[model samples]
Target: MVDTTTTTASPGSRLLGLTTLVGLAGLILFAFVLTEPDVRLHPTTGEEFGQFDAVRLLYLHVPMAVLTYAAFLTCAVASAGYLLKRRPWWDVTAHASAEVGTVFCGLVLVTGSIWGRPVWNTWWEWGDVRLMTTLVLFLLFTGYLALRRTPAEPQRQARRAAIVALVAVLDIPLINRSVEWWENRTLHQQSTLAELKIEDLTLFTLMLGLVVFGLVFAWLMLHRFRVGWLEHAQAGHEVALAIAERHAEMETLDVDAAIGRTGGAR
Candidate 1:
């Protein structure tokens, strides 16, 4: 078979790489130098919550959380598209986005835990509806990834994965609204971004973080989608080779049987 894959980088890839690099540099500059150092106050107690340096983690945590949701949303949409169109590219896209989204979701949990430890005086709280729902969301997608890994026919696997992805997305709204729905039971604060009370520099830094992470997600999705395509092509090649080997084996057996019959007749 001819190796049809291209080795040359496309213009779009170069542009994406450049944009990601510039966004990352801006994120670092804004995170370290441009942002103001001011302590956050407790939402309820009106007392000093923590040092500004520790609170700076919000720049990383919030953006990661947002990106996690975005990635999963992409996965869900791709999954739906695959089911409707029955296209291999849609399955590839759904798989790639799920893998990237899973990583970002894990980061969201880790960073949120680190931020919560000092502020809430707990590493985790089972009773916190937001935390619990977020954990559930992570686990559901983790299961979706696991389902994709199990051996099956291509269409079967894609169908199963799509169903799981769609089901998993149902948790997203629940997770997002957990803090609001169970306001009395959770320590997690309501959306402050909507209120716009955050300082100018801090808000700017957070927005920069979002842009950087969003670019990173896009770059990873592109690479991962390519990888999925390569894997699918390789699997097809292996199946063809297996079929050819089986055909050759059958031909050899037929030749042997014919020779034996002719010798017996002689």
Candidate 2:
């Protein structure tokens, strides 16, 4: 028997471990130090917006949304690459990124809703273009993932999934620009990073959050890609084993027929 198991970590896994540690430390600093309570005036009302503590959620919420977009963009690029290059690795990468993107997109929606409850006095606004478009974006990617799971030949499944990924990405721009495209219809505020008035500490914390989430996204994608590779490898191995077993069985049947024919001749 082969010694298939080993206690060694790959370079990629080591890098991901280090990143996870650093990201956790940064998030801790973000929670304890950088996110100290502070007040800001409402952009439109010219009145006090007392969400000093609640606004801390913005650090996570904004970064999660950015990471979600990053993952989907990665998926789209990988899908395009697979279509051009016909490499299995590209298809695997696209599938992994889409899965990660879906999870992060869900996080964005959850955090946004939590923030909205107190700030907007509503958990959701059906008519809000940004919110509604983001929901649609999430659903589209979910459908992309489901399409990947449909039973088909490996190449056919990959081709179908790549197409879905490409189509799903069309919604990304719409979700991103929905606020600007329908400015009056959205309750969501335009990006505060565009304004010069945001406090330095808040911006710093948000940047930290982005860094942490980016690292986390990288870590997840790496692991997911490896798992996909392993699954592909195992599938090929199974097919090889099945072919070999069938060949052995045919040889046995051939020998049995030869023995019976020899006996008849005698």
lDDT of each: 0.87, 0.86
Output the number of the lDDT-best candidate.
1
TM-score of each: 0.86, 0.87
Instruction: Give candidate 2 misplaced runs (Cα > 4 Å).
Output: 1-11, 41-48, 250-256, 259-266
For model 1, where is the 10-residue window of minimal lDDT? 2-11
- What's the C-alpha lDDT at position 253 in model 2? 85
* Per-residue lDDT value at 145 in model 1: 88
lDDT of 2 by residue, 145-229 (tens): 8888888889998988999899988888988888888999999777678875687877888888888888899888888888887
Give me the overall lDDT of model 2.
0.86
